[model samples]
Target: MEYQESFINYLRYEKRTSPHTVVAYKKDLDQFVCFITEMVGEFDVNKVDSKLVRTWIVSLMEKQLSPRSVNRKVSTVKAFFRFLMKEKIVETNPAVNLPLPKVRKKLPGFVEEESLHHLLDDGFFPGDFRGVRDKLIVALLYATGIRLAELMQLKGSSFDTKNYLIKVLGKRQKERIIPYPREMNNLLFEYLEIRNREIGYFPDILLVTEKGKPVYEKLIYRVVKKSLEYVTSFEQKSPHVIRHSYATHLLNKGADLNAVKELLGHSSLAATQIYTHTTFEKLHDIYKQAHPRG
Candidate 1:
């Protein structure tokens, strides 16, 4: 229990993990602790064996956690055991040989291009203060294929409109420069100028509301949903779908897999491979039309 408190403190202070992440980790750890308490009334975690760990996992399976969720719990337990080992509390890690729960790979749902175009076009109320900003938010996310968190971090100082590039901070604080079309660069520049001059917004963010505050998650979602409502009839619509649309369109137009991987800020090529599935589906359609296989 003392060690758990220390580990949690380390997470909050030393690691600087977010409240949400720390809470999730604690909840996962507590579930294991509760199971151990109920099983034997008062057993030391250091004395736990692989057999006990396996049984606990079997109990978790009966509770119907999804494979992915169970796998995450397994990962949390492994980390906890590793921490104990580092502190010399245990002779061996008991969860070492525990079988990882298998997870299915399902493709993320993304909006089609026609729907995306209609959605973006609907946000083009040029005269209103927030309308223009919201439209650019949607456009820039699609144009650059940046993550929501990365997009939220952008400042007025980051854009290089003259060179048609936007410098972005990607995963693990790594910075990368992404190029955009001339039209996008122009749109961003125009929005920036208006943002600083007419709206009197702090010239720090490329996108902001009327209050000069950096846009957050709800704002981003609202912008995406509002634009989507105007353009397409798809029940599923969000800023991430715009990103998916960008990646999908790139592949449909024959962009290299490696290049798309970097543009999307993915840590691995495997993460970017989902777009290839979209391209393969499109290729099959073209083949069916061009070839007389039917």
Candidate 2:
């Protein structure tokens, strides 16, 4: 367990995995370690073997975990064993030969373009400071397709109005400059004019609470939810829903796959490829409506 904690730290610093992901990976491996600890009545990474790994996996199956969940747990095991092997702590890697379960790909759910228009129209009127700020948040998300965490760290000075670009800190501390449209840029400026009007202290973040605090995750969530609630009739509404909408809408608009991928800050084109399904579905509908084949 001591060494396991050390390995988690290594994941944090060396691998640069998010704290959330590191915690999940640790939980998975700890569960495995507990199983082996109970079976052998001792803790020794060297004592692990393929049999115990198989047994634990079977137990997970009995517990009714989805194939995707099982596969992720197995991946955790593989990473842990590989880490142990690298340190010469284990004679052989038990998880090296372990197999992953296959899972069907489910397309991401996103808001329709009409729904997005409705949502934007529903925001409070005539330049309410918070309204302007929240609307800009929505516009920026759609325009740039950056993640919530990346958006949170954005600073007042990060926006380059001349180029209509924003410098955001992304996963693994990597920084990327994402350009937005004139509309989003103009909305951002309108929000900026009201930035310091609040009573209490304010953080240097681009978006903030009315009391001048840096915008927390919950505030962002509520902004997205409230805005979407008024504008659209969608059953599911969230920040991520808009993110999916952003990608799907872009692909539908004939934006290049790799270009959208970069805009979304995706590490792999494979991840960006999923939006093709949404674009294809739209194309299918257009063909059905326009083609007079009957």
Give the alpha-carbon lDDT of every model: 0.80, 0.81
Against the hidden reference, what TM-scores do the models get?
Answer: 0.82, 0.89
| Per-residue lDDT over 231-287 for candidate 2, one digit per residue giving the tens place of the 0 to 100 score | 666777777888899999988888899888888878999999998987888899999
Report how far residue 14 has shifted in candidate 2, in Å.
1.7
lDDT of 1 at 73: 85
> Which candidate has the top score in lDDT?
2
Error of 1 at 99 (Å): 3.3
**What's the lDDT for candidate 2?**
0.81
Report the poorest 10 consecutive residues by lDDT, candidate 1. Answer: 119-128
Alpha-carbon lDDT of model 1? 0.80
What is the number of backbone collisions in each predicted candidate, taken in the order shown? 2, 2
